[model samples]
Target chain A: MKARSFRVLTSLLATLTALGAAAQEEGVLDSAVVRNRLYRPAGHPELSLSVGLPVQTHLTAHYFFDVGLAYNLFDTLAVEARAGYAASRHTGLARSISESFLDRQDKKITDELEDLWQMNFHGVAGVRWAPVYGKLSLVSDIPAHFQAYLWAGGGVGSFKRKSVIQCSHVVDRTAGVCDDRTSLDDRGTAREDFWVHETRVAPVVSGALGFRFFILDKHGVKLEVRDWIFRDSYRVNLLRDDWEAGRETGEKAPSPGLTHLVQFDLGYTFSF
Target chain B: MRTFPRLALLFTALPALALAQVSSGEQPVPAPGPESAIPPEPVSASPQPEPPRAPRERPPPVTPAIQHAPVRAIEASAPAPDAPVAMPTPAPPPASADDTPDLSSEGPRTTDASQQRLVNGAPLYDPNVNVHIVQKKRFADEGHHEVVLYPAVVQLNGKYTNHVGTALHYVYHLQENFGVQLAGQYNWYSDESHFNLELIDKVREQAQAASSLLLQWGVQAGVEVTPLYGKFAFLNNSLAQFSVVLSGGAGLGATRHLIRPAVANEVDGQTFQVPARYGDTGTKFLGSVGGGFRLQFGESYSIRLEVRDLLYTARVDKVDGCSLSDFEAMETARAGNQPFSDLKLSGGCKVEKFDGVDPKTKKNYREDIILGRDLVAEPSSDVLNNVSFYAGFSILF
Candidate 1:
């Protein structure tokens, strides 16, 4: 074993020595870098569409579909405006909690849960800063060029919240049913629900890190991880009896904190 | 077998060579080296019989600047008069007519040498011998060893639980694009997330014990493959090489559970804040699959960003080495204020762990016996997936 180690060490030293010699023999290293960038998007106008899926679902899930318009002022910078609607739904865990919480009458008073707001329509204007540009050899002959960028923006969005704990008109309390359904076991037939609902317009902020890979002329593909952040507002210290009798009950929480919805976005762009 | 150490040496030394070139920025242009400047030995006067020459390809037509250039001293690295040279495939035209240089034009050299961009001490004005956007790989990883340290591995998809930790990994490259790895990680902070606490607080509902089980530390042996590599420039100033790596492994990991959350305790009319308590829940089989990018700096160092999913089977039937039956006995002993030493219990049960009082907080360990029993009442089981983000740096040698 010692002899093998010695031989290995000797071979490594010899290999490194040969590499140094070869580097010098080549005169100079290949230093001619990105000066000859084959594609630059400066002064170009573009249209793009993107779809975002939730990275992780907890109480809710959101799928966002958006369309965007952008103008590149330089190869490294651009201004873009995006507008979209998000399709949202409650998760299985949330539904399970709602179904069970209705039967637990022992807890006479409790606070409403947080992070129940769902976004519907939204628009934002953002700046994209692409500081990294380079080329990738896909195979022996094909090459792919790409840019890494960061985007940040803020705008107003329409949001709505439906309380799972509050059911003003209970259709069937023993079976834990609050909706207008024809059968007790089948919830699919529900036409309307008695849960308390509220709607508002609030300011939202978004940020992302993404890569844009240019294809043939005038086209590109993008992949990104984006986070939509908004402040959470909910009620606390509610009287269960008051809410069950179709009456307003709780006061707003002093500090409701913030909610973040993280998504993975895939997009396509067409330059005009 | 002989190829193993050669690959190790290749992976180790290649990064160092790349670093040496990057750090040699002081000289924008190296002085003409002695080897390339030496002319070939006189062909007319040879000491031996003439040998059959290998066939070679014709060189491309040179532009005026290259034909009458003053930098003939640096031509040593160029191919001999009758040698084959590989020319990179030229890039396609840009989407719009912007500042992109037209490589197709064979017109007079417009840019002066001084105005030319200097990369790795070579001017970009010379395309045939120097400028290459997607050049051949300058480093090889075969037969090399690398050690990586991740100061922060944060759980990205935490719904019931969250984990933050530091990890260390070692890899031996058996081939240029494939390697074997041994990895170990220790999570300093692992707990049921606030979302889980909110469910318990606002809705009186909580995740089962197994669903919120925490991983303390893990070790695994696996294989890694780098299928693709490329280079890019940062805002036209700096250049770096990167590879896409995917890896998978299976091993063992220590698990635990939060027995109790922090609460205010009253001791002799003085209230003290007691910290949360955790109970050891034994080890479980661990498996992971991950993918990420490794951006090489010079030759020896690199930055890695990856996402990994760690999966483990969690069955909360025991805690602190005490099984359900042993906990039942301990709970009865605690209720009756009887000595636990007389009870018939499993050999692995560590009874002393649940029979003492905390020295500072004046909290009795016996009070937790009931909570531990509640966890294993029905024996909840789950396969927990801990997906996390790993950001770290590595050194190859």
Candidate 2:
């Protein structure tokens, strides 16, 4: 397998080299025209639209769409505002594994794990810097502009936490009776009766590194690796009376600390 | 006895006759000839004469063996070229009057003294020679001056109120490796308790107006060091340039803690009120360290991406709740450079810009502002510890 992959890579490199040679011989990449047509002059504003998929997420798969507006403050600096909607879905496997482990440890868990939840929307304002710029000769005479940039900022996010009771009854079999009369199955006929618990908004911090290939002066494609960090807390719906009584007792629920959601996005941007 | 003797004699005689016949068949005697009597001249020179030919009316069909006989006969009959034989030489083609003189036929000629001197003089230019022409050096001896401005939203730690702000940075490069920078940022605080409705209602019940934390603007002056600068050849012989810049600076900023007076609410025989407030507005000294990469597009424009940590002392007097006198005392102590108990860590990109000048107007083009200031206020403390990242465009003149 390794040898095959190496062979494929070598073949690709050879093809690129051949194409570059042909392009150079033809003089198709006129430097003068490229200089005039490929770069955005100073002090121009740009707008971009992007869609991204979370390559690595804590417990779910997330996909998002973003619209960004940026203003060039200087030759190397820009301020930007980005707003986007992100949707999350549970992989189901993670929940199943967790439930299975819990079931083995304590047989009281008779129900499956709940589906993962996510934030539906977020807003961010940050600065972007194109710190490195260079040209790559992928095709002989034609050069592609390559740029690497990084950005970070803080924003607000609206997230909903939905969970269903994992067990219908957690009773002592020796007593032949269930102790917690208020358990989901003891009172409710359906699972949806005690499914959703709460919805809350939290602060989100994010950072990203973007590599862009400028095919033209005003148009380019960008690949970005981004991470969003935030705090998340939710009810597990495991215990019975203690869970309900803890709220009145001013006891804090168990929290999952900070969660990091990493995503990769490929999109295009047009600069004016 | 006489019969036996006769049989034995016959058998002996028969054996002798058979032996004699075998000898005669094996060796046929040569016919006596006058040629043989002449005594063969030195054996090396004597050729065995061809066997007496048998004349027949029709020639035998030519076989492979007969076909090769003529070649051997011709080789034997041909005379050697150097055997004292004479041959006529062929006449050369008639020379034409227009024929050019052959230089190879001319004998070597000695060079004249002047001619030798001329030959030794400076060589003349030849178009066929591979001459390397050096291109004008690029990115050499250029001025390094740039300015950038950006706006960003900051979250203090992960739980503190969010601040929206803008920052301006100025950099002047003394050499390729070093530069001085001045940067300033202004931020206004916003209410974040709304993220938790329960917290908002509880705070609202205690204070008719929503409580909020406020952070004023700050400025910093620092030195920037660019330790590395490099270029990469992109597609089509295009060059892209970049640099790594590091910086450290110190500055001062202020923060305000505010709360509104309100009536208390009792529910389920328990009193629910907003948490007591800490001391109000005060100023603190701050320090920042950061590094970034700058990618230059052309002579006038570039993009910068940076990460920085802003550090400052936070003074929160938990014992006294929202007391003006206590806040003043803390301010006095801060002015006296008293040691602070809390340290805040905050950094991220505050701004990134890409500027382009309009060709027709020859002026910097501007875009409509898309982000508006957030005015909501919520409960806040004097602590600010956060990290930030920024991207922006810069102009170099």
Candidate 3:
């Protein structure tokens, strides 16, 4: 492990050195390596258009659709907005194990699952900046197909996630689903309907390097993958407390699962 | 093989047998755990050699007499509160029974009518330590510091755990408890299950039972004797607790998938075990703040309620499982190893430790094969944005 780590470190250092050399050849100074890059002054394409799919690591979504545009008036900065749609689902389980009402006393429980699904839509807008370009003079010819841009911008994005969960019982002897709602927190209690949702400003701070695949008819397309740190919250059901109460014999129906959301997000950029 | 059938028969006939045991005049005593419930493997003083440690001969029949005479129980450890139950119920009583045990079977203990009627005689808590199992829900995550606890009011706590699977936890409290909690909490969420699994995607029913247990303990430096309170009106003698848990814990999570290893073909006849990549485990961060209320019950047992918020990092892992979603994308197999078989971790476990890869073949493991999409991968509701209060009885010696 130690040797492998050493090799990886050395290789990374060499990569950094190569990048520095590439920049030096362009006459870009050392201090401005990250900031100085070329960009064309903006003539906001009369109408900016974009369409892309959402990408997430775990949460399932039916599909995600994104549409956005940018109007760059100056070579240094641009304004942009994007709207997205995603599908999400909520799933839960009610666990109960059956034993011989005979000599065996302990029963190992397995969670019985019920799932819920829903969709959400969100949007964002921000001012993008290219600090190095539009300010410095370049003696060498700017590359026609490439521009390394450093953009720092903040925008608001939100999503609405929802779901519905149904409970079923498992008979130990049969080990099959039974009409036994008793496995649920409310078991035989009257069933109820509820809703949970949340909205928060998702951060769009990012840095990118892209090559213009093609620009024509006052239109241009670029492919770039960027990571944007973000935050959001959602709700979940109240089954765990109910299970605990079940173990305790007479414990009351716990407050239905409290609903809260985890906060974080990452974004990729595809320009058109 | 015959024994297994007989065992199955025996299991089916258990309830009837119990009824017979209760009604029979000679009262055959059956030890709950194992035969060792009796005592004196070698008796010291007896002229006629006695059958030592016989279940029927032993005393304290209703409860295991290991410690405080257990209150009567019916199930494994439930309090059978009814008259007949006080004698028949046998749960939660043996939590503290491991003291100087007199495991002698030929003793005075028997299920007498008087013992069953004696309700108020048992101690507040059960004593058979081995018999009692407790699983406490911990909101170990203290939430996001950027939103909640900041510099002035530092929130520090830790947890550690050890279990058959991935139930290990440990934390260090650096200063929250007066510089006591140097804590690190990890909620590892990876890809295993997905909620949006399509119907044609139904998998053979099985248990992908992965569990997590947390432990939090560390140097508690604040006024050791200070009392905290629960916010509820009914709470009494609330304890202001702030401690860091020395963290050392591991998790072994097992998920079983009903596999259908099929081969898919390309434009040409060359086939491969459907090459697919599984997604992430949607684990999240859980944070909580609450205290126990030692309700003025017979014992110092309390009602514990907590207000907590659970946060999940935006998952970068894809949520993929065997589903018709990609059914159209499958190809025919060329035949070497099973396509899904590639997911098997190789190098015997220690060496097969690659994240999301089939360590054995070093191939892209498909989630659909290992963890079907219908499998709930996101933190299950059991550990979701959870918030609940437990009003159970607890005792501190």
Candidate 4:
């Protein structure tokens, strides 16, 4: 009777052992399935839309809109192409002086001061490097992925601005007669005013630092600080105060020099 | 002696312990207490085959409990063979599984092929293919013809007035180095108030009054040589084309010297007007040399700035003394074949200079015959040197 009891006990133990083994195997398979779902791969294309506030030093400031297309050459490297419209307004000092000149009774000087400040349209192609990538989990359940990147490029900008000149009454409004007072040269029939408009094309070098936060897998928001270095040769009365002093002494005014611009932007990005 | 027996009992019970473990499972279990030890028996010591049970029979009530107890013990003791290894968790999948792309299968995402490659952290080449590259036009291309028209203000150096004029030029380029051009210009100068009325009246009385300051027109045929051609970036970005052309030519010119009455006189209480007269009108030979630069704005349009120097000689009729009524004396002196005399003054007396005796009259003549003491005269002929500049638009075909 005892022998029979022992056999039954052994058999029951064997059955329980098999059940335990089966449960462990099932757990392993579940873990693997979860891992496969979370894997992320490299190499994707990104598209972005950006709106910027561009400030040109001592020149103008305005809003700009840009659309960019970029491709990931590596896990952390990309090439980007951007085109944008830059709309700008004259600086406060520039505007005030322009308004003052425009209010003058002399139509010639007023016309020259009109539209003296303007914006430019530009294009850029650059390479971006994402050297730092990380994640943040401020909330217990939600996590965020982000990257810090820097970029540099070169491009062309089309700039149009008006040129201004100050003249004396004896020199005539057109100033063409200033040199030869004795000669009766026919300065073209007076248009109600006098001013010369000039357009220029400039080469620009640009650089930027940006932070991108991926709110979703393929979408993100970015904040950027960028600068464009270019030369602008639009003549303005930068030395208007000194020039007015010189004018009182019958001296000629000095000419304007070259300047540059900077911009800050917030944007959205989509990756493919 | 007590220890030896206890060890002996322990050894003897080992077989039963092995049998019980094998029946329960592969999991190890704690050994039973010595106080509960049982003697080794044949059924426990020898490996024995047990009878198979019916497949439908139910397991004993202790079976589930015993099976679970060993399993729980083994789990607490050591990990199972198939248990997951402790490792960091991977990132979660995208919001939507359908949105996750297989990057390897996708086509080239970048617009430029070179962007796929990298050097030093930057793209190997610029991805923007639309960058503007300035292309210079070949000079020897066919159909190089151009026409230009300009309205210019011309000032003749040493002349009192500026000439407002229009100029036209037609050029046919045979080669980059040289071309032929035909040019013409017409100018008109208005009268200016530089001299007083009294001085003008004195000049008019001597028949040398100046009316219009300048009136001239001319046409020229020339060959132009382009000695230099170059390009520079405007605002350091845009390409601008420039060429220097040197030109030389000869042409015919017409000039007129007009005289208008300086003052009106009242004769017999009736105001009489002095009719205007043409003092001289002549056509002369002229030569010009010039140079200019052409700045190209587009494929078909350009701006040209030129400076030219013109040389010509003009003839004027000499007037003697201060009278306009010397016609008879001038004719008699000419018919008599006498040397032309310059009236001079000595001690308030009018004197005329005669060189030798008159052959027809057979009379000796004084060499220094005084006509008047304070006579003033103007010269007859002069050379005019003019430099002009023009700016205009040019069209190329």
Candidate 5:
């Protein structure tokens, strides 16, 4: 009778073991949406070169040329350092206002315009967090793998301000000319202007939303919309007579606000 | 002591295990291969399987008939039940499943082929066949309606004028890649930007009339086409689908121009702040072209980020139905303390708009006659492009 009980117990144990194996297989059937990533950047170092074009121009426009070095800590995160020089200039609207303001003697007492600061040389270190990875079917046979990422960082930059309202030495008042040109009609002939200029070093913050498209194995193409933000500092409550006569006229504004330089950047990268 | 407790627990669960087996059907489950996990393909019985093609060749378009057909052996890892795996499916060089021939009675597929396979499912005789990557679509968007609400549409290139508003759009999917859309936008806050105001305040200069024209509202009918779609994994945990959408439309928009900025009014020895004034510039023809990404979440919800350029023809010949001649007469009449009621003006002119004095600020509207005249003196015209960023969500039904 004891032998019969042992055989029944053994059969029950074997049945449970089989059921457990089937359950484990069922769990494996629930596969990940994307089973494997095509490109992984972890533990790799990369070098990049980029050019930035102004998205919109108000008083000023900036064209940035930068080179970056980055190290990927993980598949989704990286640290990077970028250094660049921006070739900056005043927009046509700013030039129009500056030339016309030279002749406007009726407006004698007014505050200087805000957001005249322009960035030149800058360097920043930032972390890039790429939380999204995907692939695009470019054509019948080609699949493009890419990552969407956000980057943010802060650094110091050399900035300069050229006053549109204040010309230190006016050449002609009635003709609305502030520079030394051979003829009044052609302002482009002039090499320089007499606009009051100031230069300083200040902190700048930059943020971007971008995509990195992986090519083959080590190469990538990047496109992004980046914004460089900095605090604005300008003089307020100025006298036209004081500035034209080459005399410092106004006091610094208490709260001048912030300036945003938005640009669209296209870049290329190579990984090591 | 631990052994005794474990034995008691196993005995206690024995009845529940037996009940579960009884509830579930008695059919012995197949040893789970990836093919066993797939539900039965709704294809015809005894269908002949196509020979495998090269991996790089374009797959046949997926029509309704082909979509219902059994998943091909090349597309899935499993060989047909009848075709033995040891013998390579003969005919063409080994290729991805995308190279499959169109066997459906209907015509070729218009949309893109299925996504490339990422997971290795079944073992193959040729190791290279294992690299063949293509899988059928898991979701379809044909014949559905989507209503999108853009809570914020902020102007990106606000050089002279600033605009912020909301927009609502309805889209009907005619096909997987094509759709028809009706879009409407209303700008509740439209005004001269601070940059323009600063130029006026300090340099005594401002943007031309046409350059600073503001859009109050617009309505457009357009078509949207999605050229590309893909899947993305977020933080290695969540997955979402996205499509690159491009759209174009032509329509009409209402516009206005700033007549006067806010100023302090002194009436009877007391200073009162008077608000800025805007004059209606009537409706103008508008056109739009835009492109962006639509990130879809599940079946009925999505998030869209787009940049649209709202182009409008701006010709400022009249303001508030008052032409240059009308403004000249109003200014002449105001110079001499004369009532505008007696002046002869166009029948459509709203002379009353410039005749009254504000009761709160005690500011006279007649003082704005010269400013109104200045706007029409040159009759500036421009094709203004107001590029803006739109962030919104959608509900698909």
Candidate 6:
């Protein structure tokens, strides 16, 4: 199953890269070519970065990261990906549920995310598109590219929530311990599980403004601004129903809402 | 023992507050001028000062019909009371229909006006000096509109009340009373309280978060009126005011979700056997409530905070398809030709009369049903959490 999934992922990436190469071949006036011919090619790929708090509690959200990518598509569009490494912990009600289930003294349930998916490792891949790819010139009446458009795409986003809950005696209402207590399946027993995501399904939509620049003529750079609306399997309920009384994990979120991202994309789209 | 410290703190603070208010230049005197040399009464919980009146050119002498009114005097002396201590004047005979004074209430001698009066207390018309900012928040009331792209059967999670399910809600409030302009609020919730707790017993902790679309069709309207308008605060120029409002309405809702009850059994002692069942269903409930806001946000759009407990319920999937009364016949039929399993019929799941609690029995039984159903609420749908989420806009006239 893993191998088959990997094959599909590889083919998908290759196909996307081919589309980019093919689109560039159309001599669609390479955004890089236009920049080199008209504006001074910039030295660095115009990138936007941000390192801020991951609005949660108890856990120190004091972390920072940058966003941008390395790729070229067009003056209005570019295929790039964003990566950030920050210290964040899973928390909130979701984590709280998992903690409750994990109490060995109470539920005694052991099966958590580690048992369900990541006993060893997990991986992530993404595709970022910066529509309205360009730079901004000061003192120019022309409002930076009259930038606006619709963006719909997907990426991986997942957070963790860890909570500790209290578990006292568990007895059926109006009944004694009729059911035997020992050797219940770990999944069915009282336990806590860490809520983690193997892959976050994110589709994107956006509008942006900026200008394009090229360095050495072959490299296309853009400082684009985008108001991105990410449609992920947005979970409304961070907690799930099936979660055992004390043990629960993973995102039992129902899809409903969307996240907003005001990202600045700066990357060099190699212009052949 | 722990609560004792808190009580002491409050006791100490109350008197200190009165002293502070008295020391402050402004006197929240129940009566104005030297002749009103009365001791300050202890209505000090409220720091609001009575607004100083603009000197009126020699007014006529005091009316013989009413003077030395102890109640008014007490009300005047105690600038701030634990509760409302209005004037002793026989309210100008309710001149209007809307503002008619409800005297049946407040008829008791709560206090005497004469006993309450401060030396510097001055007569003032507008006492609510605090900034009585009446903000109006308006929510776009477009009927419940949403599209569910998910195509999985959502099971019912034993969480939220049966008040909602997979749905949409559009809320609008005219924060004066219980008057809300609802473009629409439709909710679908079923009472699954009797949901096969049996199957759950057999199954392990493995759970699934069902999606749901809950729509609540209700209207809310309330107004925040500064009861004692123009009553000034001593610390800051901002005035102090108490706003009261009453709001209520009714609406129906549609709820739909999946009920995949799982059961677990001992399988050869090594592993447990479990099976997941598919049951998609919906129920409707009528919800209403009256709540007061401690503080309505200040202006056009301020944070409107409130503590309200709304009551609503939904029905769950019924396997018996029979009411409790039907059980009488089923029990008798089972003794002869009918198999016990065959007798299992789904009567619309209803909370038994005994479901709430049995006072005589002093215990909860099957008849005692828990109100409301649960929500996952439907597959791919996330209405709100069990604790739930409710937001709205409020406008006051």
- TM-scores for all predictions: 0.79, 0.34, 0.26, 0.30, 0.77, 0.27
Better of 4 and 6 by TM-score: 4
Candidate 3 local lDDT, B152-237, one digit each (tens): 11011101111011111112222222112222222221222222121112222223322221212111111111122111100111
DockQ of candidate 6 (2 decimals): 0.01
Which ranges of candidate 5 are over 4 A from the true structure? A1-31, B1-137, B264-266, B269-273
State, as a TM-score between 0 and 1, how close model 4 is to the true structure. 0.30
Q: Per-prediction count of colliding residue pairs? A: 10, 72, 91, 10, 6, 147
lDDT of 2 by residue, A55-152 (tens): 53323667888998887674346788889998776555433333333234333212222224576799988987764444443322234555656677
Local distance difference test scores for all models: 0.69, 0.42, 0.26, 0.43, 0.69, 0.28
Better of 3 and 6 by TM-score: 6
Q: Candidate 4: where is the Cα deviation over 4 Å?
A: A1-272, B1-143, B156-158, B190-215, B237-239, B261-278, B318-379
Q: Fraction of native contacts in model 6?
A: 0.00
Worst 10 residues of 4 chain A by lDDT: A27-36
Per-residue alpha-carbon lDDT of candidate 5 for residues B190-288, written as tens digits (9 for 90 to 100): 888766777777787888999999999999999998777665655543444467889999899999999998899998899999998999999999999
Model 1 residue B309 lDDT score: 91
**Candidate 2 at B1: error in angstroms?**
99
lDDT of 4 by residue, A1-272 (tens): 11111222222223222222221211111111111111121467779999987522332565778899998776457899988888765565443333234233332221122224355788999998764443332222233445556778889888766433332222442333322334445433433322334577878777776667776467789887676666544333233333333342222224322233546789998877
Candidate number of the best DockQ: 1
Give the CAPRI class of candidate 4.
incorrect
How would you encode candidate 6's per-residue C-alpha lDDT over A121-203 as one tens digit per residue?
Answer: 11122333422222222111111211222333444434332222222233331221112344343333534333333443334
For model 5, residues A34-135, the per-residue Cα lDDT tens digits are 324556688889999999998777778899999999999987899999999999999888888887788888999889887778899999999998877765
> Considering every candidate listed, which one attains the maximal TM-score?
1
- Ten contiguous residues minimizing lDDT sum, candidate 3 chain A: A134-143
Candidate fnat values, all: 0.21, 0.03, 0.00, 0.00, 0.19, 0.00
Name the lDDT value of residue B273 in candidate 6: 35
What tens-digit string does per-residue lDDT give for candidate 1 at B166-271?
Answer: 8899999998789999999998878787778889888889999999999999999999988777756555534555688999999999999998999899989988
